[model samples]
Target: MDKMRAMELVLEAKSMKGLTFSEIAEAVDRHTVWTTSALLGQQQMSMTEADAVVDLLGLDMDVARALQAPADKGSLDGPVPTDPLIHRFHEIVQVYGTTLRSVIQEEFGDGLMSSTDFRIDVERIADPAGDRVRVILDGRFEPYRKW
Candidate 1:
């Protein structure tokens, strides 16, 4: 099966099985965010990881093989996101882009964060009035090369 088709089957099986990303991640012994990303085709998976997910989701071996293929990455299909939730993230960068650049440059130097060597986390904070979600993007800072 193609990666996209395999991804669709995986999603269907996951929904039918009523399994959570956290559960799948635990079964594969991987971080939830990374596992989710791999399952969504943003990242590649090892043969073992892919097999475990395939077996857990009751999917075919073709899905496992597809998951092990190279990822295309950056799955967004437009210059600007139309989905409300995703758009909010784009809006955040639009609003804070300059400030974030300045802050990072001030603290780290003239450089960029390494998305290739990054980790993300999502957490829930309980409050008396409401619950809060915290998203953390942790990436290695790479100072600019002065060649």
Candidate 2:
């Protein structure tokens, strides 16, 4: 099974089984964010992780194998996100990207966050107005080397 096909199957199984990404992550011994990305084909899974996901979701070996393949990064619909939920993220970056960069650089110096060592978390904050979403993006800082 190809990666996209595997993702489709995983999604289908997840829905059919009424499984949450957190539950799948627990079964595979991984973080919910990372496991969700892996199951969605944005991240590759180790053999053990793939096996666990496949077993839990009742997927096939072919799907497990597909899960181990490298991801096709940035599979967005177009230049701009059309989905409301996803578009909010794009809008956030558009509004706050420069401010974030400045603040981060002021503290960390001339360096960029390393996606290779990144970890993201999503939290729900309780409030009377309404629930709020808090997304945390944490990564190691990598400075540019002066050759």
TM-score, structure 2 vs. true: 0.54
How many Å off is the CA of 27 in candidate 2? Answer: 0.6
Cα error, residue 10 of model 2, in Å, equals 0.6
Clash number by candidate, in order: 0, 0
lDDT of 1 by residue, 81-135 (tens): 8999998887656544444554476468799888999999999999899998899
Inter-residue clash pairs, candidate 1: none
Q: Candidate 2, residues 61-105: lDDT per residue as tens digits?
A: 999999999876545444668999988888655544543554455
* TM-score per model over all chains: 0.55, 0.54
Cα displacement (angstroms), candidate 1, residue 77, comes to 2.0
**Residue 6 miss distance in model 1 (angstroms):** 1.1
